[model samples]
Target: MLGLVGVDVDGTLVGTDNRVREDVWAAIERGRAAGMHFAICTGRPAVGNALEYARRLDPDGWHVFQNGASIVHARTGESLSAAFPEEALPGLLNMAHERGWLLELYTDTDMAVTQPGDVARRHADLLGIPYRPQPPEALEGTVVRVQWVVPREDEGTVTATPHPGLDLHPAGSPVMRDVMFISVTRAGVNKGSALGRIAQRYGFGMDRVMMVGDGENDVTALRAVGHPVAMGNADAPAREAARYQVGHVDQGGLIGAVDLALGL
Candidate 1:
């Protein structure tokens, strides 16, 4: 039987409205009732709506966030997160400032942005948080991830830039399709590696875990899972990595994935 289900946020859970569909929530409840574990796996930081969702999913279980830079227990506030490579921070900060880019730095729960404008405001809304932009130096806790929130047209340039000791994962939200979010973590931290850690903590192999997702960043976890389920709207990389396909997120595709997990 599948022991756990890891779900992506933007495309797999919520669509453009940025709210979890009622049917998806209902299905998750049913899965929980049947003793199935559910986890929110995403590029989002562990704060605001994301934190709330993690607690709601399974308060006692582990959830992966920040593209796997964070793995926290919803109820206990305990973390099995990878720390950001501090040595790489100065160069990234300098580069973003020089380029006038919208760069964000995040700890396990708090975040700060270099550019707080329309994009930052919209992101704050999506995160279900207030629009208070704090500087990176003022943020409390161990920093884990940094992201570049730029227009879709700038994705290529951002990814092409070289940053030693950092790994970049580019992703998009259905709600902000015109924008690209480039997440940077330590050299090897990602959803796949983090999922493995979560599985080990649970005393199970990754084959017993099912991952549902629909984006480029989801590709790593998708490829690592025994049952890789993709939403209908999944990007090419995600679809290619997944072994199963569900309906679109807007149409409550998560229900199908949950049902599959329960039966498997």
Candidate 2:
């Protein structure tokens, strides 16, 4: 039986409305009853609505944020692992400036944008977090991840750009289709790497963990666990990486995926 389950937030647990369906919550309760723990794993920073969601589900479980750059305990607010390579900041900032894209720098606790834009405002509204407008020089302390918010159509152009020192991944929402997030992390720091660390910390082997996700950023995470369940609405790469495919989020795919993982 799986001891831990890692769920991606945007497209897996929550629907386009950014609300967890009743059935999803019920499934979570059932999983808890069966002695399984749930963790929120997403590219989002571990604050505001992101931490709130994880605390609501499993207050004591490990929560992964910044696409695995930060792992912390939901209840105690204790960090297990965090990565912020200061060396990669200059190149990432340069890339975003060259494209005239809005960049958000995330620390383990706070998020700040170089300048606010429509996409930044939309994200702030969705996450229920204030987007503090700060200069790049104010990005002090540990910077876990950097995000470039671009138009959906411009994703191709940004993807084509050469980012030699960073790992760029695409993230989008069903509700906000016009925008896409190009999340940047230090090379080799991804959801999969974070999940591995969490598993080790909890003494659960890869085979004893299950992962559910449905986006470009979720591909590596899906491939990290032994039971990788992809949502039907998942991106092509994510679906290909998973060992199983459940229904879409609208169809309570998380419930189905959990059932399969727990052998219900």
Q: How far is candidate 2 from the true structure (C-alpha RMSD, Å)?
A: 1.5
The best candidate by lDDT is 1
TM-score of each: 0.97, 0.95
Poorly placed runs, candidate 2 (over 4 Å) = none
Model 1's alpha-carbon lDDT is: 0.91
- Span of ten consecutive residues with least summed lDDT in model 2: 80-89
Query: Compared to the true structure, candidate 2 yields what TM-score?
Result: 0.95
RMSD of 1: 1.0
Highest TM-score against the true fold, candidate: 1
- 185-252 per-residue lDDT for model 2 (tens digits): 88888898888888887899988988899998988888888999899899999989998999989889
lDDT of 1 by residue, 170-228 (tens): 99988887799999999889998888888888887888999999998998899888999
